[model samples]
Target chain A: MRDEFRADLHIVSQLLVDMAEAVRAAMRQATRALLTADRKAAETVIAQDAEVDSIYRQVEERVCDLLARQAPVASDLRAVITALHVAADLERMGDLADHVAKTALRRHPSPAVPAELRKVFTEMAGVADRMAEKIGTVLSKPDADRAAELDRDDDAMDDLHRSLFAVLLSDDWPYGVETAIDATLLGRFYERFADHAVNAGQRVVYLITGEPTA
Target chain B: MRDEFRADLHIVSQLLVDMAEAVRAAMRQATRALLTADRKAAETVIAQDAEVDSIYRQVEERVCDLLARQAPVASDLRAVITALHVAADLERMGDLADHVAKTALRRHPSPAVPAELRKVFTEMAGVADRMAEKIGTVLSKPDADRAAELDRDDDAMDDLHRSLFAVLLSDDWPYGVETAIDATLLGRFYERFADHAVNAGQRVVYLITGEPTA
Candidate 1:
């Protein structure tokens, strides 16, 4: 590769790493906002989504520029395209954070989620955070086994989701139908957030092994 | 492109189109199963889902092979990657259809939805089907204007969704909470299915104009 092209590739790689970190930060802030019902924290998450979105756009433009200029081949092209998809998943994760925050604002003054449900959500968030953290590692080290472990963690999130729904279905819950709906939607957002993280991890597997994993 | 590469690309493209059509057919069958309370039809939809899943995996494998073999650049690369993403969306849509059909099966013998509710669902299905058809065109033609119109149609689906929920929530409703929950989940599946179709259309716009919408 030419020196200038090599230099641009390094910059692109750095940008991708930084974008993943930004996505992780957004997920953390959003989870905090949901768990604590902190309006200011939620606002911070909401505000940072624009930054994530901007970074996503920037990454995409840079990728397109690289494709046009250097005409990346094989693994290089996979890296660029995978970065595009991971950036999107991260951006949507931010949107889900925004969703959780919006839900918090609406259900404020009244704690819509019971303490037990909150416990389950906290666990789910942890699993999601771990998965998002691994997307970066998976990208830089495409052959790593850590990506596979992230897939395993997604199972825990699914379990939590099932438990949440089971609680909602229980007769002991005297909460109104609206509250149940809110809880169900909230659980779904978290479940989907983790699922996207799993997707990012799976992309890493595909980037390396060239095969889709469950 | 070499003659062999071009031939393979042609085959892959045709398969992608076929997979989308098959998904649409599965959805139609599932919707019919729901409207008519046909357990037999519901089972058929469920059985066909395996075929849809297999086709999606085949599409994924072909796209990955193309990415590795031809190393397509720029627009060609975008088209291949978009095909993979669109295939995933289509497969997920089929699963949602199966979900709807399963709900129908559960409520069979004593029709979960009344004639009025069935009419609403039939109309909603018509709108959803159009959105799916538009998505197929958007993928093949990469037309920005047509893609934008699909977004407007999505709004109509949202309105229908709200109306469905409103009817479910009314005091005049005679069904139990289980029935209400089933309706809510069914409506959600269709709503989300249309949303993904819209996402596919948006990607087509991006592919054509190299600009992001929403």
Candidate 2:
């Protein structure tokens, strides 16, 4: 029975890692769509969001089944509960990526990101991408130290997010209110994607240390 | 043991209601601060957010305890899991209110919302407030029919959010990009607050019906 419980827990962990990967790929494609105005890439990200949601639902069902059948306690119980939280954060990350794709599609042929601001967004996307990747690594290994690194990556994303605002608010910004609004929402989408990634990392830390990260 | 589980579940439900009330009050204060540029009101909302977070932590701990001790199955297990999800949504609702308050503080004595756009924000706040209140109602009663009403309220919020962009994009708009960015983000904060409320309502429906709401 103990062996079976451990196996179930492992399955849950692997499912979370799969979710992280899907979210990472989605964000990468979404960023491509934004940078190049690739309609096909945007459409792919928007459509594949359902696949991420499907994985999230699977995680929930598996966790519920484990709890009902095994009645996992102590660290095991924490692991099961944390899986639910991690899956939720990853699901939201996928949605953020979809939001980015939709934003790109909203402008269609015209780039959602202005050329002047594209560098900052590229940096933001890179940071978010790294954070999502780290989320997968941390989930697979359950390393508290590795999970702590996502917080630093989140800081980098924040710096990029602020830089995005600086450009938007600059005296020379020629993009009218519509473009400014689009950029504002786009920046928020990337920033929140990082936030949710950090959240998932924290849940992993909590699972390992039995102590919630502040 | 069943009786004990029932008692504990009741406590969790009541805590969710308290959280709903706290979030509703925080949003109300936040909107007041945004419209009036009242620093004190903004400060109050920011400070009281800790109280909401504390309640959220309490809910997490209680749900953990319940799961470990009772190992509830079937409908009982669904109720416990839904409590955790609902608590999370309510906690996020608190964060959204904090975001609104901080936006108001960023602009200080000048209103974060322009005088012309105040009516739309007021309408948005009203829809959000009503949705939060309805979350408490649905959670307490576990009525799927009542929970479904939050979806309609969310549609109203979406309309107000769109109308806000129309105002910002108007040719006669005198406020520049900085104000536009602030309004855009503030609009998103209120819109997401309603979204979370709708999410909470859906969880309640899931709990009662044993089917996830689409």
Candidate 3:
């Protein structure tokens, strides 16, 4: 029973890492769709979100089963709970990527991100991608120091998000209100994706240290 | 021991109800601040958000304690897990309210919402207020029928959100890019608040029915 429980915990940890990787890929493809207005890429991201949701459901069920049958205590219990939280954050990241994809689809054949702001969006995506990668590492290895690094990546994403607004509100912005609104929401999506990644990292930190990070 | 566990479960339920009410009040004040440029109201909501966060932490701690010590199975386990999920949703609702308040504060002395869009915002707030109220009831009583009503409220909120974009994108929109962006984000905050409330309601429904709601 003990060995089986340990194996189950390992599976849960692997699932979280897989979720992190999937969300990273989704955002990457969504960024591609956004930058180039690729409908197929957008559709692919939108369609595959169901897979992320399914994985989230699986994590929840497995956690519940472990709690019921194995009754893990202390750090093991924390690990189980943390997996639930991390899965939720990763699932939300997937949804944000889906939102980015839909935004791309809404303006199909025309790039959702204007040429002037593509650089910042690209930078934001880069930061988010790095953060997602770090999340996978932390989940897989449960390293507090590595988890802490995501906060800096989040700050970088925030800077990129603010820069997007500066460009949108710039005097030379020619896209007008409709595009401005879209850009604002898209910026928010990327920023929130980074925020959730930070949250997932914090959960892992808490699971390891038994202390919540601010 | 069983009796103690039941008492803890009861306390968790009450905490969820309290969170619902607190979030509802915050949104009400946030709307007032947004419409009338009431800086004090905005500041009040902003400051009181810590209370909501504190309550959320309390919920997490209590739920974790329950799960660890009691190792509740079946319905009892569902109740504890649902409490965690609902508390998260309510905490997010509080954050959305805080966001609304901050938006109002950002335009201090100037109404964040324009005169033309006040009615729609008011209606949105009303629907959200009702949804929050129902959330409190359902959390307290665990009635599937009452919990299911939040979906309709969410639909109402989505309609209001759409109308907001319609007005913002209309040809006669007098607000420039900055105000438009603020309104867009504000609208999103309210819409997401409703979405979270619906999510909480569905959790309650799942608790009662042992089935997920679509």
Candidate 4:
């Protein structure tokens, strides 16, 4: 392997890991904003998304340069292409966190989740954070076994999403329609954040094995 | 243009046009299913997404072939890359319609939207269908001017999405929690459907002008 090309690959992979960590931090802050009505935290998450976007665009340009310069074929080419897709997923995970933060900012000083829904969203946030952490791990190591675990990890988020529905469906539900809408949107943000992480993991596994991935 | 490469590009663009049309029809059918409680229509919409997925994969492969064989740079390379992005948006648009259909199928005989909210979903579906139609037209012509029109079109869908909130927030709201959850999900599907169309339009503009669209 040429030392320079190896360096390029290393930087690309490392940037993705950095982006995944950024996504996790944003989600953690966004969750705090949503749970505690911390407007500052929400604004911070939203502001930080621009940095993620810039890094995403930079990674995109680097991939294009490598493709044009190296003209890589087969598995090497797959690595570059898969990196593009995973970069996109990481960018979107950041956007999902931004969405959560915006919800918190919009509701400012008032909890997006009513008292009843707080515990479930908190759990959802925890699951999403864990998934984000795993994306970084899988990116650094490209472990097919560890990458496969994200799907099962996401099932817990889905189950939490369903529980949110169950509560909304229950006759004893006391919240008004505003609360219902906030809860629904907040739940979806967490669910999709995990899905993007799962997507990134799948890309890692595909890059390692040259298998098809969603 | 070389005769063979021209033929390949033609096929790729045509398939996207076809996929865009399929997206429109799927959303139309899903809206019918949701509004009329037609399980058959919902199933048809769900099943048709597979076709969209196949076409998307084919487009991707063709783009890779073109890039490798043509080694297109500058505007030509942008066209190939932008096609990949547009194909993704089309695939996701199909998935969004499928989500709407699944919601209908899940509710079975009961309409997903309560009687009062039916009018709004109908309007949202109409906006989505119109946007999908525009995507087909833009793909065929590559008209940068026409591509910019999608931005304003998406705003209408966003407005319709907000209206769902108005009804939900109303003190006179008569629906149960199930209805609230269903309405929220339905609104999101249509909103995202339009957003994907807008994304495709942005790609079209970028391909034509080599300018950033989003």
| Clashes (candidate 2) | 0
CAPRI-wise, candidate 3 is high
Q: Give the alpha carbon lDDT tens digit for every residue of B111-182 in model 4.
A: 778888878888898889889989999998888888898898899999998898889878898986677877
Sorting all predicted structures by lDDT, with the top scorer first, yields: 2, 3, 4, 1
TM-score of each: 0.84, 0.99, 0.99, 0.96
lDDT of 2 by residue, B1-214 (tens): 9899999999999999999999999999999999999999999999999999999999999999999999999789889999999999999999999999999999998888888899999999999999998998887777888899999999999999989989999999999999899999999999999999999999998888888888
The most accurate candidate by DockQ is 2
User: By descending TM-score, how would the candidates be arranged?
Assistant: 2, 3, 4, 1
Pairs in steric clash, model 4: none
**Predicted candidate 2 versus true structure: per-residue lDDT over A1-214, tens digit per residue:** 8999999989988999999999999999999999999999999999999999999999999999999999988888988998999999999999999999999999999998888988999999999999999999988777889899999998998888888888888899998889999999999999999999989999888888888888
Instruction: Please give the distance, in angstroms, between residue A175's alpha carbon in candidate 2 and its true position after superposition.
Output: 1.0
| Ten-residue region with minimum lDDT total, candidate 4 chain A | A68-77
Lowest lDDT sum, 10 consecutive residues, model 3 chain B, at: B138-147
DockQ, prediction 3: 0.84
TM-score of chain B of 4: 0.96
Comparing to the true complex, what docking class would candidate 2 get?
Answer: high
How good is chain A of candidate 2, measured by TM-score? 0.98
- Candidate 2: residue A8 Cα off by (Å): 0.6
Compared with the true structure, all predictions reach lDDT values of 0.75, 0.93, 0.93, 0.86
Worst 10 residues of 2 chain A by lDDT: A137-146
RMSD of every candidate to native, in Å, equals: 3.5, 0.8, 0.9, 1.6
Fnat per candidate: 0.10, 0.80, 0.71, 0.41
